[model samples]
Target: MTDKLLNHRAEGSTTAPPLLLGPSLGTSTVLWDTVAPELSATHRVVRWDLPGHGGSAADLIGPGATVGDLAVLVLALADALGIERFAYAGVSLGGAVGLHLAVHHPERVSALAAICSSAHFGGSQPWEKRAALVRREGLAGLAESANSRWFTPGFTVPELVADHRDADPGAYAACCDALAAFDLRDRLPDITVPTLLVAGREDPATPPAHLREIADAVPGSALVEIPGASHLAPAQCPQAVLIALRAHFSGGAKHGMEVRRQVLGDVHVDRAQARQTPFTARFQDFISRYAWGEIWTDPTLTRRERSMITLTALVAHGHYDELAMHVRAARRNGLTPEEIGAVLLQTAVYCGVPAANSAFATAQRVLAEEAEGTGG
Candidate 1:
């Protein structure tokens, strides 16, 4: 069930749903080598090299190639491979392409996973300058910038350095140009695909804020930040990334929606009823089946354990309201006072004392309510 299509090839389980994976800037399908084996164990993976970047072909669409154009090439590759509907995952530029496809051609993309990417890459003069350099002097001129953003100084290796050096200048420049003109900020609301955004905590280029913007812009998209990792999170933390991605696709919308509703409750439905917006009905449907049914239904962990982890995460992140509500739910999940205190103490060191203090205060208030209710 695996063969070369127009620009890509399929791998892994033939019976399982196919995953169309796109490469990052200046990388080839080979970039997925370290991670593909892990993903392919259960699902069919389709990895592709953008034109002029890898073994597929050396055709440069030039600096004028738009994100939309890259998306079209992806769709065509899927069509040529006879893949009607499949999950999509990409890194960096590849991630943006997945978003574009999910937005523009929803039916073709069953689910999405975007790593270290943004909805809008912005229009900065530095980007234009880099593109100009790549086009004129080739990828060599842009090597330092790419290296700085892609790898930590201490982790650089001979092979890794050579990989960047070996990249096709034309393809690198073309992708840089595409990114320069890419902007989907205003249109992010239209995306309905189940999406996951993964970013490195130490990533200087895309950063966690870029992932945060994506999560906020796309309703229901979950964001995961891996600590101690750089921009190459997929490579640095493949196991975590694959675990989340598989859970999303295999479980789909039904499970996640159910879990979300049980935890977040009818915040959506109540708001919908209050406003009666046209999207209200769909909103209710989405929460019930996807958030609650799929994600919550999984036996992976008890609702209580999940709640504790989620609350700890939000507290660590300084999302006060969300942290507060989850703190309340933690009691229902049977989280003990000591456990909550432990989470706070852990966050104090990693997430700052001020944030941990707020979380501890919120937890104390919720614990008092539990105590009073039991006493009454």
Candidate 2:
């Protein structure tokens, strides 16, 4: 059943981890144009069109087709692409599909970001009405109102409107039917993948509260709200959406290496790597894989926040040698000299003046040396 119900476009290097992107029911891969390219720089991004939308065929969708059926089509697409395990991010209906994958095929999904979507799309009556209207009047029946729901006022993208207008009425109606029967609220806790829920502040369709419900249900899931955007937040607020997605998807060893070098400086990282001996090789690998790759690369907190936290902890624990190295890293992560001083001052009261005093002296020496190196 998966021969061609979905139309897929793959980008990025073959060696990179596969990241599957799903578009909203009425939209196509164009929905991810702004976000996918940037993510492709680190991940192999594969964006696909929903059946009957964009270049995909509507023949697979029949009367009373369920979201599960749509989810199966996505799995088939992944199978066809030879993707065994991958990360997923989807918008609206696309997000619902990702949720389905995480719940049903947990082994296949590494992480998920469900943007402007909900576990259950309210009651079925509204969806039934939409399905009937589109089925009776064709795609033209819902084009204007649908497009309006997609974006905030004065932020329309003509390409998105065109994509909505060009959708096949039958397929769109089938998707509406899929949405009507979709109810994953009770199953939310079953989703074990590291998940992120994103909402647009102004989205009336699936409001922030809708996404919040899912976020509350899914354990260990995080929620992010985008300001000044509507249901199609990815298109309306690409940068914010991209930042959230990158943080979720960029936790691999390769990306961790890049981020580690960026924060710690290439020279310092290279020196540490060069110092790795057979006896210390395993410890180096562990820190690189766990600390830098997994924890440090997380996007939920900025590098600056991590830097400040790392410096404070070092001073509190009297880890002066590591503290000195991190002082240099903190500077690279945008912590000003004044900010570093303030951290030490605050630590002085809680961790003892002696500890803070030594930290200050070490920080001063590192800062002065850096100043001389940079001709400051």
Which one wins on TM-score?
A: 2
Q: Per-residue lDDT tens digits of candidate 1, residues 177-250?
A: 78888888888889999888888888887889998988898988898888866777666667667666766666
- Residues 1-376 of candidate 2: C-alpha lDDT, one tens digit per residue: 3456488899999888999999987788888989889888878999989888889998878779888898899888888888899999999899999999999999999999999999889889999998999888987656777766888777877887888999988889999999999999999999999999999999988999999999999999999999998999888899989878876777555666777898888888899889989898657755765688868977899988999999989999999988988998998889999999998998999999999999999999999989889511
Ten contiguous residues with the weakest lDDT in model 2: 247-256
> In model 1, what lDDT does residue 128 have?
75
Q: Which ten residues in a row have the lowest lDDT in candidate 1?
A: 1-10
The lDDT values for all models are 0.74, 0.88
Which residue pairs show collisions in model 2? none
TM-scores for all predictions? 0.64, 0.70
TM-score of candidate 1 versus the correct structure, residues matched by position: 0.64
